[model samples]
Target: MFSFRFSNGPAAALLTAAVLLTVPGCTGPGAGQAPATSGPASGGGSPAGTASPGPPGVFPVPAATLSIPQVVKDVEPSVVTITTQTGIGSGVIYRGDGSIVTDAHVVEDQQRQPFKSVRVQLADGTQTNASVIAIDDPTDVAVIKADRSNLPAARFSTATPEVGDLTVVIGTPLGLEDTVTSGIVSGLHRNMPPSREQPQGALDLIQTDAPISPGNSGGAVADATGAVIGLSEAYLPPSSGAVAIGFVTPSATVTNVADQLLKNGKASHAVLGLVPADLSPEIVQRFNLATTTGALVIQVSPAGPADTAGIRAGDIITSFAGQKITQVTDLLAALRKAQPGQQVDLTARRGTDTKTFTATLANTSNTG
Candidate 1:
């Protein structure tokens, strides 16, 4: 199933490899995480008559430290809660003109229905109506427009965030408005498999340890200084004892897609127009392939880039552009970094023969 939020309330649902869980809401791709207020505050009040700790006993530092709480206060206003007819999720104000950015899966109905009216809850709890302007399903990004103005637009950082950098996620998670969770950037360039909502899947996702629940999708993932580094996307549930892995769309991609959507009503992504399968021992034996790694071309669209480059269905793509392609995801990752009309080199194997070709990229939305 797609990862969009479900119509039901926020609760962790059992998920199978086939069923993609949404952030929360109705049980789709993205909603938000559970509430951050799961427990009582630490260091509860001291006894009424107890005196403050003496100097030798070590007095608590007052206003002597910088903290994330201050960052939250500064950044929360740019995050918002988005509710459609069937689901609820989060979004970020991308422009003062009332343009908002969110996960496409959030507003996507069960049947991949057309855009519909949505209610946006701002940080101050003010509500406004919005219209879906453009959606890029391949990247799971969408842009919407509201009639209102003077919105709190989020500021983004251009500097790349390193692994282990402090991070905080802000969103309307678990139906909780303006929730904030803290963690660190744990990884980068993570590739997620295709789901019902994203046919080609998402590439180069920012991985974090922050608590991202069902409603967290489309929310802001800020650095320690409060500059948005990415947009919360999805989180991985415990598997084989592994836990707390969340993902986000990096700020660079967000800016590029949002800019394109605002300007052209759609975002452009390079397309190969071919079906690819990962090379494995089973696939190797089944297809009598020449290699046990790389992406196998199963079908090439007529007149598409691969077809025009003389790539056949039986060819194994070993590399694309300047990167080595070990699987279909590698090809996808490379494609995301390219633009339409860009020429890229490809290396493939046909039987025992290895050949190279240059293919011009094309936009999937343009072709369709």
Candidate 2:
């Protein structure tokens, strides 16, 4: 099994205690344990029209390049230190009206409730009381409102950064405010496995080599141009001792979810409402099935799209929308890429027979 650290920033003992008591089936990484898996590429390649310079890092840094100090000066003010009763993390000023955006897990207490009185500390050492406006649990995004205004909102870029592009992480790790670390965009669109805290899992994650430690959660991962490209989330450590790998939520997804939370009081996502298990050779042989690859429906939500469409347990899902469903991840990625109220075709294998069904996705946030 793959292992990862959520990178929450609290002292190891406190974090472990809190997590064990609250997050069911989720365990924090021990000192020497390393990640068991590798992540997908972030599409790092030479820019179009620019000749490949043999390989990355072959060319020297340009003389006029913006220094690390310049990046810190340009973006530090917009990053804030977020403290809850149980943990400390980071946040970015979302708008001028005193709204802040951070990882939902950062502001939530062990019970997953928004802390009654969260505190936001500005770069100037100004502390303001904030209230949770909305929390998107599935996506791990949250919006909070503070009493103060005229905050410096961080500039966000929807353009995905190329792999090898400079990535800077600004956050309050270990309670140290305005700390900055630099690395390259290692990969993008990586789909991390689901956890009890986030059952839907994190999709389209931007992977970087930046040292994202505890307290860097919800911090900003800015590109070389000083545009916010992603939000620091988690890291994977090498088991045998190697440089740890980090993951960030892309800025586009963060902005989109934040906007939805601001406007609709919740972030909406397409839901099929079915519990799925990966189909394997053993399962197929035991059940005497036809295909080796696909997701086997183990449970279906009543009145949800999947159930209403006549999908049943023991059925192997072969395809969803236009995407082939070889495993549970493919189905999840396809659903995440779709929108609510969208109708799509679903193919499944039932007792040596293949059946097709139409399903209209719904928002679990809005629907029962």
For model 2, residues 256-363, the per-residue Cα lDDT tens digits are 889889898987778787877677678888988889888888878777888889999889899999789887767877787888889989999999899999988887
Clashes of 1: 27
Task: State the lDDT of candidate 1 residue by residue for 68-101, as single tens digits.
Answer: 9977986799898888765567888888889998
The true-versus-predicted C-alpha distance at residue 163 of model 1, in Å, is 0.8
**TM-score for predicted model 2 compared with the true structure:** 0.82
Please give the distance, in angstroms, between residue 227's alpha carbon in candidate 2 and its true position after superposition: 0.5
Which stretches of model 1 miss by more than 4 angstroms?
1-66, 194-199, 239-241
TM agreement with the true structure for every prediction:
0.81, 0.82
Residue 179: error of model 2 in Å?
Answer: 1.4
